[model samples]
Target: MRKTLLSIASLLLVAGNINATNIGYSKDEISRNNVFRLGSTEKQGQAMRLSHAKLQALKGKTIDFAEFVLGSKNVTDKKMHVFLTKQLDGTPIAEGTVEVKKALSKIKWTLDKPYTITGDEDCLYVGYTTEVATTYKVLMSDGSYDIEGCNYGYKDGAWVDTYGMNKGSALIFVNAENVGDYTDAIIAQSNFEGYYKAGDNCNFSACFVNAGTTDITSFDAIVEVGGNKTTQHFADLSIKPKEGYSFDLKDVDTSSEGEQSLSVTIANVNGAGKETDTSDNSVSANLFLYPKTMERSLLLEAFTGQDCGNCPGGHLNIEAAIKKTEKNVIEVAHHVGYKPDMFTMSEDPTYIFFYPNMSSTFAPAAMVNRNTYANVSTTPIVSATDVNSLLSTIYYADTKEPYVSLYLKTTLDESTRELNVKLYVLPHKTVPHNSSIFNVYLVQDGIEARQANGGDNYIHNRTFRGTVTGNAWGYLVKDIKAGQLLSWEKTITIPESIHSSYYADETKNNVEAVLKNMSVVAYIGEFDQNDNNKHTIYNCCEARLGESHKQTGFVKPTDVNSAEAEQSVSIFVSNGKVHAGGAYDRLQVYNLAGAQVENADLTKGVYIVKVTADGKQTTKKVLVK
Candidate 1:
């Protein structure tokens, strides 16, 4: 393969030097992927699932410049107006206004301005139209999609497509003489951590900023290592403007290891000012030394529900930071999440297709391993207080170490209720270039429910019981090596249902909850329709479906409205019938696990009916046949 793609482009040109060549379609391609936002001053205006930007992946290709890469999750810096339309309801062949202060953004706007696109439906629409700094996002895609210039909305200047653009695919990186430079500063964050021994000394850290409008009093931090290079000048420091100035290189030397290239730069102060864009000074990572011990774990998902009253104080600050830092942490709650409570099961589109806001707009939000939180705000969400403010941030993922090492083992039959997981992955290092996924999730425990204050006997535990590879984004951890060992075999169908309609009385189909408090959670993160910090989490484990033997039932709880729309109630399935009007009043069905069955003949899986009046009750889940 051309000498393995030229020895991986000669180890990324010995690691740093940002722009691998002046080109487009890659600012890590519309980074931080998403949390799905396009102007949300509170909702009621959304679209851009395609506003027309058809370069068809740059048909014949030609470009010197073209920029639009946004990501200011829950934005607030203000001023955003970017476009390039060609039809989705057309009218903007070029537009401007971008200046939203960082949350991991890259607003190049328009530079060098050279364009050329041709044939096969030539389209072009790179978006961004605001309503006072809401949350902006880009770079998202799933399954089959072709470049849908997404989520447009900018009244008072035309450009409206606010339809229900919730399928995914956004993050357009259009460029030519390329690689990013609106005044640069690299080494965003990188370090392999620990043992290299000999003379020790393997450290790293660099922030340094000034992203443009030149004016840097002085700077220097270059560090290479292979052909050797090291510099550190700081003569008279300044740096304020856009703010960023962290430092620490600790002299890196790690004697000699199996793989090493170490690069991190930020220079440009010899004569002070005049660094327009040295390709972001530089940034790269890789160092693996080997020769001994390494252990790591972290899969905490926890999106929480029960009608969030600050989500039971983020579920009592994640069991008080896992019993005061026993930290090996492997939780996976993903309940109803970010709004709706009553313990949302697998509902809300598989936890908003991987937490649309899984890390706090509020809901006890958490994602210790669904990654995010490295360069901060790239997208793991994070925001669960208490427990000493979450023991200084979940023990900082237990001080690093996890290139890959997920271990899972499950096998439950209990009379064909089926479940057969088996994941073992173990990379240890080298296997990241973004594009990995292996979530398993099928949790359950004790069940008790209700928790605006965690009252109704609150005991939800790990909850989230669905997706045994039934698509909560499973598979895609490809043929990695280093201790090889990879396996796959999913088989789930155990959803009786539960999301508050708390039964056990009116025969509402029995469900006091407790499938031996099932458990299966797995992990091995990284995903990027353009790097949302590659969703982080590189290892995880969980396996306790009653140790594969013993069992029990009527513990079905999982399901938050299917098509959204349930602040209290409103469900309608049709044909086989299952419509529980707003406030409910006696209905009853059950099945995925609850038991009441026979709602006079309904088929096709997933049930969880239950309704009632007077004493109060309400729930929904239908899949009819």
Candidate 2:
């Protein structure tokens, strides 16, 4: 998904003349990663409409040719029909047909007679239609980087906007000519940290495209923030037509606090003052600055499965990286991508949707902090072999401040096999309502499982058990104010089935859920209801059951401790006996099956100790060793 939406005011204007130039929707090179089609035997087609702003420069120009790219096809009878229309589903102003030949090959159809643009029409539609018997995928692209007025799929005789549906734009373009000379530079994309701290030096970057016929030799970039402007110049460069150059501006001042709007503009193209098209020369973004910085604990959500032969390498690489950095890194291994195993939870499939495209959906892949780190892949998904990139991202992300801080506490009931968790969210700045979520995951360590290459009885740690928040995307909260403390409590029942292996006739039992080996991981992240790829974690923390954990961010609210002390009931194990402290009305013990044990001979194992004080109840897991 695009980080920022491009409006008509941000679209580049192109000149059309006798010197024909290819015009299309995609700004990047087309690399086939996935394919799309309506259905077998059904006419599959894709179309693009030139925006009014883009057509202004070509008002009187003519479209001489229509070109398109297609994926591999088996049927020889399928013919691609290309058409140009003033309106969708309208009579074609110009049409041509070509035989489908090779894969990833560009097929062109020279119009019998050129169709001139009147500039009165709202937009010009260019599309191709074809029918296949069994091979339905007729079009292909890298991924869904939707742009308005582009990426329309024809289905059931109606054009549907496939935005956020993974239906990438069809590789179709037109050769328009007959206008005049023009110079234009547009910011195709921009990047910067999501959040920053006051007084920190921020960095910014953008991809500038030469949208005109003239080559760009010199240019200037200006960044404005907080009423201050900084200009950077570049010279002795040659950027040809339809080409892009990326530039980075480092150490921009970020002294202003609160959410600040930053704008970047391209100026003096070829050192000839402003270009003819200025609408696309500038882009703006919002960045938040916090008064203080918090120490961040990164979260690594890994995708793997028992049947994956290369999965063990991913585990070793992650473990080695953690040991080398010694950073507080919390990991959750999801049993997905290759095949489902006993550890595969109901929500595990949903996590796979976090992949930017179908190509990156594979085992031995992981998302660090759910962020697209600088110099890394454009998407959050990274291969396990890129350990250095992973480390660099971890270090870079750790230096940045989070918008909110997370604190977690967990209590386990061995008898009822329930885990209770309390999550506290402290905001450093005001957060918009329904824009973020809090995710809680139950992960266990020391599980013996079969590994494709490492042999049976492989110890799998940080195995995802389930979601404590019920929803895989987490719980959404209301508007939050700075210094406000918000908390959520949830009770999760642990199933006994987790202790057994359910992988391909492998009968392994007694893989106990050791109390000391289990932990609850929680984090706060920004959520986009429309696009999962935009979700990024803000902050995270982990807490083990029946133990104390500490994290640095905000001071723990004293009122919470006071309230707990007033109704506190301490349950502990010592000298092979379960001890209960503080005043209590009743006390009892039970086994893992929720069965009460009355004065039974105890052994070296685990038990659930429950106590009721002043009508309030609490449970704790006790281990006798």
Best model number under lDDT: 2
1-625: candidate 1 lDDT, tens digit per residue:
0000000000001113334223221213233444344433432122233111223323454543333444443444465566555554567655667675654545566632445545354445555654433333432322111112233444444555432343233333444322232333322323345434333455556453343323355667778865577887765655433334566775677666346777777766435454543543566566665433334567777776666677776777888787888867877776555554444433434444444443535567676665554444345556676555455446665555466545455656566455555554656456644467777777777777567766877777776756676666677765465544454544454645543333224434334435567777777666664434455566667777635311111011122121112223434455676654335557888887678866655767788876766565656666776
Residue 114, model 1, lDDT: 49
TM-score for candidate 2, please give it.
Answer: 0.62
Error of 1 at 18 (Å): 52
> Which 10 consecutive positions of candidate 2 have the poorest summed lDDT?
1-10
* TM-scores, each model vs. reference: 0.26, 0.62
Model 2 residue 489 CA deviation in Å:
2.7
All predictions: root-mean-square deviation over Cα? 23.2, 9.7
lDDT against true structure, model 2 = 0.70
lDDT of 2 by residue, 1-625 (tens): 0122222111222435446666675543456565666644467778877756557767888888877877655434758888888777789888878887776767788899988887777778888877665545666654534433456777766787665464445677777775566677656545554656678766567656666767778888888876678988888887766566777764467776677778888899986654765666776777777655455688888988888899999899888877788887888999887787767777888887767675457878788788777477666777776678768767766654577776676767777676667777778777654578888888899878788987998989899877788888888876777767776766566766553234444355434566668888989877776675576777888888744344565555675454344326656554566656546898888877888876345678788878888777777677767
What local lDDT does model 2 show for residue 505? 48
Relative to the unseen true structure, what is the C-alpha lDDT of residue 415 in candidate 1, on a scale of 0 to 100? Answer: 61
